[model samples]
Target: MTVKGVDVASYQPTDYSTKGLDFVFIKITEGRTYTNPKWVDQRQTARDADLVTGFYHFVRPGSMTAQADYFMSRINLVKGDMLALDWEDTGVSNAEKDSFIKYVQKKRPHTRVLLYCSRDFWLNRDTTSFAGDGLWIAYHNGKPGEPGIKHPWRFHQYKTTPMDTNTGRFDDKAALREWARSKTP
Candidate 1:
């Protein structure tokens, strides 16, 4: 099985050789907390690692435009990578959700999007309008199986390890990527 990559935050090793990864998803911030102590020093950790690095925000379902503006302020998004929205149960309005996506696309036209959430959350979502947007689904387990979701996901965060600083060890990045590539437009 081909191992694709891993996601790390600012505190971990910035150098890539430690993991020999292909891609990385780094957390820039969540809500008003812009300063991650670990991310402060290793801002270019993923680039240094020679990995296809991407950034994501832990969103709280607010004014979509305001949230997008906040994200654009801090993140210097690299081209040819995804800018993900880590959605949680923040009781966000549907209008806000639509506006958020529209604003983000307007600001970063080339940026692909991923709507990430857990399986339970996915089942409970009202994301009918948000379909066709790429997904980075999170479902943690120790092994592989046919992922259970009514909606299709671009990638799945399956198989975890204790070594994770942000989340857990997702040992299926490569498989997820391959699946996403095959499925994505």
Candidate 2:
């Protein structure tokens, strides 16, 4: 079975906690200078709704370590919480992406790091070297599986218009919980 979830940034916080959503990935930071002002409240609401919560950082085109440090400073993540890097900019090199992921992992050794990128972007940009614990492939084709994605993806963002809809590729919520539990320190 596929577990449904949604990713939210400050711009998309309206009605963020609808029923039946199993998880939420909220934007915590962008680059080295910006933190989502509403992340704390959004996270609280998501938790109150009993959804598994994760955080993501929108990478910028600068010092990878500084960016990672900026992201680390903004949010307090507990065990079982996921972390993601939203990589979409063609300007950012693969080496930079790798360094950023490594920097974040070095800081938070036990947290699961997911690489979020669109299927087209991932393929077209030749980003196979961008390493992470799992893939969060975004393919807005209103379909389930991404046809030619080389790596295994744990989450797939299948839609984005009305809301960013995702499906967790797990047997059930219990399995996803177990996966998160195992990844957490």
Candidate 3:
């Protein structure tokens, strides 16, 4: 089954209804510094659209604990399926990365903590060792490019219709729901 989803932040899908979107992974925080501007709206929109939403935090090795705590504080996880950590090497030490992932796994055992990274990260580094848990691969190979990750992915952000940009209209809700149910346990 193809897992369908939407990756959201402040600017990208602002004001857009996620009526047809299946799993929504909204950015809750980036390390200890940034938070999506429309994070609240995005969460509410996903819920109103009846989509299963998960909150993801961008990890910064130096501030791992702070970032994790920030995410746990901001996101309303009652409707969320998991906690995601997105890390990009910006001087983040391997030790720090390992510590952060381990902390999240132990703290939120009930909810899956997934790692989202590009193929370069997965192939070139020790990321696969962590894949024993699970990984959300982001690989795109389209001309115009898709909204979320592309091609071979654990989860794909296949289509996107701007909620605010539309005249408040959407058409893919049923298809998205059906697709979501098929992939989810």
lDDT of 1 by residue, 29-137 (tens): 6665464456534546666655555567777655666667777678666555567776765576545555666677677776666666667666766555473256666
Per-residue error at 73 for model 1, in Å? Answer: 1.3
Count of clashes, each model? 3, 0, 5
Q: What lDDT does candidate 1 reach at residue 42?
A: 51
Clashing pairs in 3: 15-164, 16-163, 16-164, 17-163, 20-173
The CA-based lDDT of model 2 is what?
Answer: 0.83
True lDDT of residue 179, candidate 1: 36
Give the winner by lDDT: 2 or 3.
2
**lDDT tens digits, residue span 1-185, model 3:** 23345677777655665644456778878877788888888778877877666677887767777777877777655623566777676566556666777787676655656666655665666433563144665545331123232333344332245321111012354543433333332
Candidate 3 residue 171 Cα shift, in angstroms, is 21
What order do candidates take by TM-score, descending? Answer: 2, 1, 3
Q: Let me know the TM-score candidate 3 reaches against the reference structure.
A: 0.72
- Candidate 3 CA-lDDT value: 0.58
